[model samples]
Target chain A: MFDSHGFHQTAMAELAVAAQVSVGQIYRLFKSKEDIIEALVHDDADQWCGEMAEIQMRMDAGELTIVETFEQLLLHTIDEKDEALSFDILAESFRNAAVADTIGTMCQRFRTYIRYFACAANDKLSGEALDAAEEMILACLFGLGHRSLSRPRLSASSAARLTAEMIVTALGGVR
Target chain B: MFDSHGFHQTAMAELAVAAQVSVGQIYRLFKSKEDIIEALVHDDADQWCGEMAEIQMRMDAGELTIVETFEQLLLHTIDEKDEALSFDILAESFRNAAVADTIGTMCQRFRTYIRYFACAANDKLSGEALDAAEEMILACLFGLGHRSLSRPRLSASSAARLTAEMIVTALGGVR
Candidate 1:
């Protein structure tokens, strides 16, 4: 319902109907729409962290290059439903303090993972340089996901590979 | 109105109240909310193109380097309200085809501007390599705008400078 109608546009009644549950039941489980969105963001973050952990393990085991890990983790294909939900929540975050808090917390977790990758790729990258690199890469990853919305025919593979290379280059030119 | 309440959630009455015009007047001007949003996007894109054109003129006059042009054009500060409206429309574009077309056309114009920057930065960047570079740079620019929502404390200047350098490097190591 949120994906199709947007977060604010999806009324409790519409959500209840879509979920095949009573509005009362939803109220019992989630205090408000924001609460429901927070839960979804938390759940999604957990899954993403798990994927990052798996990739980190591969890197630890010497099975994946930094570029390969980025490809699998950040530069991977985006699911349309997930992308819509993420943008929905992100857009909502601008107006809702609580939603912003949730997104901020989730981004902090993601930042740590990105920092780990940066450190692994180049130990010399620390302080402001490291910070800039991480933010640049994060922005690139977020931007890549958004590209599909405007340029659907543009292949993700070449973009992904180039982004991965860019990350490698940005992180002290190591691949 | 759209920035705070969202596109789908904002009704004609609320918009009328906000605009200090009658709902009937709004109806006379715009057939629906989508029409209003299309007008806004078109207006925003025109302003963006004007800025790009000015930057291009500066680059042509040798008053600004390619890096400087990108810093001024793509990596400049993002207005919070504009950012929110963009994300709002981008999210809506996922579900609304008409909105998607508006965004797509705007992006095409922006893409041409990016291509010009890329070509000027590196004549060697051609065909698929050029396409990849443009998309990568576009994603980075978009991502930088979004970073403010999640991580407000991070300074954009360093990121912007680094991103400008990264673009130069990615375009073929010419600044």
Candidate 2:
């Protein structure tokens, strides 16, 4: 209900009806609609951060290329239906401060991971090159995700692979 | 008012006050709020199409590279305050059927322009290569616009130039 209808549009009455519970039951679990969304945001952030950690570990163990590690992480995140719903809410988080803060934090964490990976991939590249590469990869991932929502013909795995190729190609120019 | 507050938040009374007219006067000009937004979307589409046509003419005259022409056109469109407002409204148009239809039509026109330029620029490339180039450029433009909204330090012109260079380098396998 919250995925299709926005946070503001999902009323307590509708939620109660959908859950087969009284409005009081809703209040017991959530203080307000904002609380529900905030909880969702936190849960998603934790999951994303965990994925980033796992990818980093794989990279450290020489089990994955920086590109492959990041692509796998992103593909896994987007492939989950619940994760996709959470992502939609986060994208629309521009309308809500709590959601925006959560998203901003997650983005920062993701960038940190990218920076670390870029440094590991090539220590000689200047900070600006690394920043640009990270920016491009991040943009490609989320942009492709948003595009895929409407253009279902483009699979998430394909988009992730393309993003990985672009990033690797860009990084090859760093030297 | 509608641009910032959204359609539901902007009452007819508020709009009438902004226009220095009675609430009834608004109904006289348009049947409903949706009607007013529809008119705005129509005007926006026409303006963008006109600008795109001018760009095409310049490109045909050898005044710019295909990538440069498209980037300039997009940068100019995003710089227009009215167009930005229209973009914001169109972002929400997913919730409105009529607005969605208008936006879809406008997007189709833009895609056609991209296809034409991509084909012209990469005349020797295979169909798949041309399609990849087109999608890469489009993704860059989308990313640049969305990023610029949050980080105004990156001017549209610089972003456009960087995006063009990135696309050309990526497609030519220079990087």
Best by lDDT: 1
* Regions of model 1 farther than 4 Å from truth: A173-175, B173-175
The top-ranked prediction according to TM-score is: 1
lDDT of 1 at B122: 86
Q: On residues A65-115, what C-alpha lDDT tens digit does candidate 2 reach at each position?
A: 877875775576446444334434544454556766766776777777767
- Candidate 2's DockQ is 0.25
Which CAPRI quality tier does the interface of model 1 achieve? medium
Error of 1 at A32 (Å): 0.9
Each prediction's DockQ?
A: 0.57, 0.25
* Model 2 chain B poorest 10 in a row by lDDT: B145-154
Q: lDDT of candidate 2 vs native?
A: 0.62
Give the true-contact fraction for every prediction, in order.
0.57, 0.09
- The sequence of per-residue lDDT tens digits that candidate 1 reaches over residues A1-175 is 7876678777888889989999999999999999999999999889888888889999989999888877776555343345667778887888889989988999899889888988987898877777877887787777777787667444677667666776676576422
